[model samples]
Target chain A: MSVTRAWAWLIALTATSTAVAAIGLSGRWLALVVLALAWAKAELILNRYLHLAQAPNIARGFALGLALFMLALTSLAVAIP
Target chain B: MTTPQASVLDDLPGDLMMWVLILSELAVFGAGLMGFLAVRLTDPPGFAEAQAHLHSTGAGINTLVLVTSGWLAALALEAARAGRRARLRALLAGAALLGGVFLFLKAQEYADLWAAGLTFESHAFYTFHMLLTGFHAAHVLAGILLLGLVGWLATPRAVEAGAAFWHMVDLVWVLLFPVVYLI
Candidate 1:
């Protein structure tokens, strides 16, 4: 698919997740939905729109760093409670 | 013969700079989210009570504004990539204006809250509320300024980068609203 089409899909996904999140459904279901959407959106933005897939080694490292940070935080949310 | 090569090289640094700025901004917002979670977990009842003082309707309106602004920023990025200068400028301006409206509404909310005896030191919940919203408000202000700077720079690539940063700001708020208000 084209970059624009991909981004549009990502945005739609995020919008759907945002709507669900706004409903204040705090539980395992809400956490699962958020994790799914967040992973999809982050991957699409990084690989497709940002073109990080073609990035140099150092840039790729930064991308990995970002992913790790996000993962750590999301894990914290799940692990804490 | 040399012009195109020079331009391509110039583009790389600018694009990289934009990414750096965006990543840094996200880090700040991430920290704020962490703080919110920590406080909420530590004092659930207090946070719930404090949330009562917030106007859900107002937060709902602000969410709409930020989401619309995110859409505009996406449009701006597309226009910039296509080298549509006029469209980029107009969209960026519109997004900045929406950010301004957000800040104005937020200020009014704060004033009203204070008048009703809700201050930062009022309680643990109120303290977190003020800190979270206050930090987000500062980000909105920064975003408005960044958009203005992007307009002044008038570089197509820079405009695209600015749009990316602005969209990230809006996305953070999307997560923040439920955490602060509904949750």
Candidate 2:
């Protein structure tokens, strides 16, 4: 997909997920859904929009660390209740 | 004027170290959200009552401000890519102004909430409200500082990094609005 198209799709997905998560879900489910949408948006920004594919190894490593951190936090939250 | 041949990522300037710095700031906000959630689950009534006091319209307006700033910052990035320094500056300034407006509205909301007896110790939700909004307000303040610096520097890389930070700020609000207002 083109960059513009991909961005639009990502935005739509985020908006829908946010609205649903906001109005309908709660607790672990809400956190999980929001986290999933956040992950998707972050990936779209890093991979598709920013084209981190060409980024330096160090930057890529940092991005990977960020992803892991987000995953860990979200997992802990979900596991709590 | 000759355009620079640098890739967007390559030209990203200033303390590239600031990216991680900004990420650390985000981690602080994330911690606040996690704490707020934990407290909410533990004391649902206090949280629910505290949430009821929040002005959803105000929260919605703040969310719009951050999102608009993000959009402007994105446009500024594109302008920087095209090497239009004037347009870039204008957009950066616009975003900064929006950030200012957001802060102003947030301060007003806090003042009103305080007047209405919604102190940090008032209830569980109030604690969550104050903590979450306090952390977010700090981010907004940081964003305003970054936007000001971007306006001053006007370098392509700085603009890109500024856009990244602004987008992150916007993203956090996207989560916060729901957690604080709707949910």
Candidate 3:
């Protein structure tokens, strides 16, 4: 996608995330959704904004790292408290 | 002169150093997030209470501003690639201006928090909150200066590098929002 179109998606996603947070979600469900959304937004930036998609290996590596990181944090938040 | 495609990266868009900076910055932010999580999970009640005082409106506004600025930086990079000097300069300046807006809003947020007597010692949560946002703000400041310097230089490599750094800053804030403000 063109930079403009990618940016439009980012802004729209931000608005959606903000709205979701504002409405107040709770428990493990909230943790799951919020972490998932954050992961998706980060992926969007890495893939589109940073142009990492051109190098598939680098892109996959970064995605895996982010997934692991978010999974750990989400687990800590949801599993324990 | 070798065209950009012949410049060794073959697939990447910018210089090696900018990628290094990007990776390092991400690592640092990742560590910070982990640290914040460590403390937060320890005192869930304390953190949640302090977190409730946080103003998501400002965080959300800053998110919108930073993301838009990151787009402007991307456009500047595109213009640089196309050898559109004037467009590149204009986009860089616009991006820098938006970065300034981000800083202004961030400062306003900090000032409000301080006015309300939330300091680094206010609580463990506030400490991490201040550190994470403060460190990220420093990056935004550095990025604004880099954007202005690169706009004046107008070199494709320099401009792309600045765009990379600025976008990295935006990306950090993107991850930080849910962890620090909402969650």
* Model 1 CA lDDT for position B6: 41
Candidate 1's residue-wise lDDT over A1-81, tens digit each? 445565576657656665775666665566556655665655555554454555455446655766675565565455435
For residues B1-183, what per-residue lDDT tens digits would candidate 2 score against the true structure? 999786555643334576566567667776776676666667666666677777766777676566667767777877888989899989889989999999999899899998997788888777777777887788788888988888678877888777777766776666566557655
Candidate scoring better on DockQ of 1 and 2: 1
Which pairs clash in model 2?
B12-B157
Worst-scoring 10-residue span by lDDT in model 3 chain B: B3-12
After the best TM-score superposition of candidate 3, give how far the Cα of residue B53 lies from its true spot, in angstroms: 1.5
* lDDT tens digits, residue span B71-116, model 1: 6666776787788888888988998999998988898889989999
TM-score to true structure, per model: 0.71, 0.73, 0.93
Clashing pairs in 3: none
User: Which structure among the candidates has the greatest lDDT?
Assistant: 3
Prediction 3 global C-alpha lDDT: 0.86
**Compared with the true structure, what per-residue lDDT tens digits does model 3 show for residues B80-150?**
88999999999999998998998898888888889999899999998889899999999999999999999
Candidate 3 chain A: minimum summed lDDT over ten consecutive residues — where?
A: A72-81
Better of 1 and 3 by lDDT: 3
The candidate 2 chain B region of ten consecutive residues with least summed lDDT is B7-16
Interface RMSD of 1: 4.8
lDDT of 3 at A67: 89
Instruction: At residue B44, give the lDDT of candidate 3.
Output: 87
